[model samples]
Target: MLTFTNMRRVARRAVLFCLGGMILTACSGKHEGAARYRTNCGICHHGGEGMKGEIPPLIGRIDLIAATAEGRHYLADVLLNGLNGPLDIRGVHYNFSMPSFRNRLSDHEIASILTYLAARGDSARPPVFTAEEIAALRAHPLPPSAVADERRRLDGIHRLP
Candidate 1:
């Protein structure tokens, strides 16, 4: 035989436990995109600001780079065909080359990664990359060197600073 007050307390505890579990799930859910991004590009981007702008961190720069049409294309091309040689990103020069991920990742995966990168950037209004757009770029695949050339042209056209 249980008292009414004890039953109420037990019920309250159960509700509280359920709420806590829900909150944890929601928090983990929010990081799903971050996880996907980490799997694809985090190795280079480092998933944090520790690199101090050395490896061309994408968290806060993707929005600015993708603001223009050419910028968008350059970004996609970079992913599709890698970027070779030295290039300046956010005024910092990084010589290490990025290998082509065209074969490693699908176009849809590319779009998802880009969208994740853009959303993680410093822009409040991040641009979304669609699978169709990535497919279009993939149709005309370019070499890494050509991608670098395109980046140079686009950089001149869309100067961030």
Candidate 2:
């Protein structure tokens, strides 16, 4: 019953099955945002947790940020224009300049990244960024300092965490 041909057949089937699964996942495009996030944002964000003292976390906070219309616009603006100067996140001061991806990433890619971050939060309804929304933000560019100012304004109204 345990013949060499039978063993070979089983091994081949296993290999084919593994390959099929990999191919299906690749084609699904479900991980497109994840792949982009890993390559672009993971360095600073570090699994969306951010650095303890340096960078601000995105996981538990982004959804809250994207909840409002102004907040959604702010998120898009941040991606397009970046943010510079001091920030008081959850009462901790962080002074770091986030580089703009305006020239580097496409609108779709930026939307994917934002959508990915928004979805990672525990919000009942996470905001989904679209290429059109990103394009709208792209049309009217703001300075990094201005984006920081917007963040401050938003913090005043929302009590950002």
Which residue pairs collide in model 1, if any?
59-121
Give the Cα error of residue 93 in candidate 1, in Å: 1.5
- Report the lDDT tens digits of candidate 1 across residue range 1-161: 78999999999999999999999974554465467667867877777342643566677777778888888888899999998877776667777578888898878778777777777677878888887999999999888999888877776766642
* Model 1 TM: 0.74
- Pairs that collide in candidate 2 are none
Give me the candidate number with maximum TM-score.
2
Cα RMSD for candidate 1?
6.4
Q: Candidate 2 residues 8-85, lDDT tens each?
A: 999999999999999986444437778888998899998998886699888988888898999989999998999999
List per-prediction Cα lDDT, in the order shown: 0.77, 0.87
Query: For model 1, what is the error of residue 7's alpha carbon versus the real structure, in angstroms, after optimal superposition?
Result: 36
List residue ranges in candidate 2 displaced over 4 A. Answer: 1-30
